[model samples]
Target chain A: MSATYTAAATLPEALAALASGARPVAGGTDLVVGARQGKAPLPDSLVAIHGLAELRGIAETGGGGLRIGALVSHADLVAHPAVRERYTALADASAIVGSHATRHVGTLGGNVMNASPAMETGGPLICFGAEAVLVSESGERRVAVADLLTGPGRTAARPDELLVAIELPAAAGGSCYARLEYRRQMEIAVVGATCAVTLEGARIGSARVAITALTPRIVRVPDAESALAGGDGGAGAVQAAGDAAAAAAQPISDVRASADYRRAMAAVIARRAVTAAIARARGSSDSVPIPASPALHGADRD
Target chain B: MRYDAVLNVNGTDFPVEIEPHRSLLSVVRTELGMPGSKEGCDDSECGACMMLLDGRPVNSCSYLALQADGRKIVTVEGLADGGELHPLQRQFLAQGGVQCGFCTPGMLISAKALLDQNPAPSEDEIRIALSGNLCRCTGYQGIVRAVQAAAAEIA
Candidate 1:
């Protein structure tokens, strides 16, 4: 048997429902799958917030940034023209998640809230300086995306808190995400890296490098970020940054791959991701391939 | 406790009393007696339970029935009209896409979703669209031809 369910029609209703101690469900891609597998029984009560109109959309923040609602489906993210032109890394990450069917059904909020260490969105979100906005009966608080997850399958969000949306700063320059997987599509990332570089004249002004699945949790490679900050965006400097990222990675041997192999692949992937980001920052076309999840020909766009 | 909900399936609505844990696939098959959708690897790894939710394909095995309340659902049964086979189904039969037939319903639903979004897709696009749906028989050659043929007819 499973827990009871409640559908919240409004934000206040959802918050009120959460007050009664119910697990918040949006998209239900992860929760329903986990429930079916008996990973954990469905909580005593589940509050569905998917129908709340307030929780869905991608909007431009007054500050010239973007506020992506928690319920924005991955399909929506990939097809957004603003996202493709600016937040290319986030777009690339969203495009590669699962298959077209899953992307149509999964939400960005669910991906971050699930707090999976190997999640494709986590690395890109952290590199782009994103923030998570959570609401509860006590009110709302904003937390840095990097600080949202404390461990695998764990989050800093309180039991009563609902992640309302994710806010991202204006895209600075060229950014891209790349992951190493056994298959080309529909596979979990073994080792992934995301890079956002702002070229200052001939030198790199600012750079952020983040890696996933190679540690207990996804983390920003500050050592690598600093190493590439003022250097020329050349192959030599990129190789050094990759070395730093590999050194910072703390991976454990698992059924997927050995620790040594993961550590080595982390460096290789970081190098490739940084190279692509640098190319895009220099006003080059995106080097990442589109996953065909969203057909641009259709008139159904936001 | 069972709650009453209305599920609009294939242009018709069926009111059902279901538990919170019941999946859309279970209710559609057991409660509504429309087994056009199959239950493969219930965890969503297999696409045998694929169905259209509000014009988008999803794994019904992992989708809660209550979550689908008031939403339009299209199963494999809905692909045909007035006993006439859908072009994709016709092509599948002609191109040998139906081998084991166990994976046909899901494959047809996935193909229908793809064709709806993209009337004419390349071989690579078709492969990527059907990547989620797996078939151990026919080696995907016939399936690929079936989709291409259907697209040609639709275009």
Candidate 2:
């Protein structure tokens, strides 16, 4: 319970406090685990930035786009009206995160900064072409979501800078996030995928696909998108995309899943994610990886 | 250094002081005399320390009292009204949701929040809601049944 000044009025104050080497705690969902696990550095100081009014909203950018504050909790993202309408997959993905209690405290910015390689939000945000607003004592700069994550459980954000908000551009059609997990919740990702499609007449105007948790960082499967774009999204389109995604993956063996198993899971998740995105683009809510219990995946509980 | 805090447990508010680095569980149990919320893991892995903040379930052991300042706090001690157990508590007892009962309060609050939002949850939803809280005894059938029974009663 060691304390530091908890002033959270503005971003400048957070930046000034960062100069004193305080751990910036937002959401406190993931960081709390680190602290409880004795994995976090002893807090020379602490800065509570959850109350900065400037960093807490999901609103339209006056041009039919969306900007989500860094402090926006997963619960808010899942329930927000604007996010529901514009980025339904993002909302759906947020809804299925960890657990109900964890979602209430976990923030989008925390996930982005945490840069967990298997993060559910990263695939959706990157596939949707989201931009992050990072602020420091120097100034503010925007970086693409894909460029932000540097490694597993890591990010490119400077220690002195804090991510403030994320911006998603306007687009046609809808997107969907799909994941395959060994357990229902509280477990890390096995394989995750995001598919966003822009429609033009009956032809595919654009397609974006991103995969994470199986790779070192969130990897954009351009080959999958190109295969979908150059070829027809008919019976063979998904198979081609899945093939490209498998080829694109550079997954290594991990305790969660073997590289071999992850390769297969990646193909499955990619195919399902693309199919769901297409269904969503055609205006349907029947997609997304809806799991069934009683007969669950992975091993049985201890 | 000692950190001063005000803990609102059950229905009463108490003024207390503790080490700057002590956990909220310490203040609630040792100082405020409310021990319904057990500390199973001191770490976040175990849900033995679950409680409600503004009615949402959270791991109290993972937090500091300062985090709940001027906020509504509810604990297992407050789940009952005038010595009457909440419906979930009664159902848990009758349905054998308690084996060792170490994880009961955390499981109860987690299930309560789900039932509060979705009165008729599917089996998968019930499992997802309770994933954060773990129980070694009873194999979870009784806990799942209790939550389903609570949902049925509320519905």
Candidate 3:
């Protein structure tokens, strides 16, 4: 527990801290836990950015989009009315990230930057076409969330470039996120899907499907998009979309689940998510069917 | 190197110098001697180190003490009003919610947060609120009942 700690009071101070070799800490739900688990030692210089109110709330962009600060926690996202009303998928993903305690401390910026293949936020961010705003002493850059990930536990962000905010473009459709977990709490996704659907009358105008835990990283399934385009938002098209998503997944066998099971669940979850998203888009349903917790029984019980 | 910061806990501020690697829970228990918040898991897995950071329940073990500067924290020790216990504590004791007492602090804090938001929470809401605070003892029957009982009394 011996390391330098600097609490930055302003944006420029934070950038200076970053430039001076201090690793930014927001929430520290991942970094602190990772350190304790011996994943890595605490950085020699730590910059505490949680005190920066400038980097902490959800705001509206001039372009009818949403700007989520880098320090915004998962709990904040779930409770925000804008997030719930506009980006329900982000709210859904935020609600089930770890437990209430972890969610209270885990920030959306942290989740995205963690770049875990099974990270709950990535799928929805990719599906919604969110952009990450990276800032440093030299200036700022915005990168599409889809292109932010280089690999597992890695991002394209430079060490000096701190993620300051995530900007999500306004969506014409309704979107929802679903993750398949074994336990009710503190369980990572076995497979997850986030779907956004824009309906032109009864036919799908456009659809975006992103799957998680079924590959090295959360990825959009273009095949599913192809299947969903121009088709009526009906059972048949939805099922085919799911099938395409399953076909696109490159899941590997792991301790959490089998490659075969993940691939199959990816399809089922995609179907359910897309179906629900379409319902929300058409204004038929105000409620999303994503379970807040694990079902009481297992697959074998039934 | 170390950081000098003021941790506002239970309506009182304590000035301390701590390393960046040190957790808020460590500072609370070791430096301030408020051991009410137990450390069940050094990671965020267990909620034994749960505390209210700005009235929201968070795992203090994974929270850096320096990050808590200027933020108000409420630990289990702060839940009592001098000799009188908070309603959650009273109900927890009355309903036998305490078994090993490790998860009690976290359960109480999380319950407080839930009640703060929704005074009349449903049974399902209570379960979801305390989902982070695991209890290996009492089957969670007592804890759930205690929260329900408290909510009814307050209502």
Chain B TM-score list for all models = 0.98, 0.93, 0.98
Candidate 1 residue-wise lDDT, B1-155, digit = tens: 67889999999999998888789999999999999899888887768899999999999998889989999999999999979999999999999999988889999999999999999999978987898888888899999999999999989
User: What is the per-residue lDDT of model 2 for residues A195-245, given as tens digits with 9 covering 90 to 100?
Assistant: 888777666668998887777898889899997774456758988888888
Query: For candidate 2, what is the DockQ-based docking class?
Result: medium
TM-scores for all candidates: the values are: 0.95, 0.91, 0.94
* Candidate 2: regions farther than 4 A off: A1-7, A287-289, A292-302, B18-21, B41-43, B120-123
2 against 3, candidate with superior lDDT: 3
What fraction of native interface contacts does model 2 preserve? 0.48
Which docking class does model 1 fall in? medium
Across A1-302, the per-residue lDDT of candidate 3 in tens digits comes to 45677778899999998998789888888788888989888898888787788888888999888999988988889888878777888888888888877887788989999889998889889988999999999999999999998788889999888899999998777888888886666777888998888888878999999998887878999989878888887878889989988998999898888999988888888887787788778875444336633245221200
RMSD of 3: 2.6
DockQ of 2: 0.55
Task: Tell me which of candidates 1 and 2 scores higher on lDDT.
Answer: 1
Candidate 1 lDDT at A292 equals 24
Q: Tell me the tens digit of each residue's lDDT in model 2 across B4-106.
A: 5676776677777665445667678887778888999876666778888778877778666666655677878888888888889999999999988899988
DockQ of every model listed?
Answer: 0.64, 0.55, 0.72
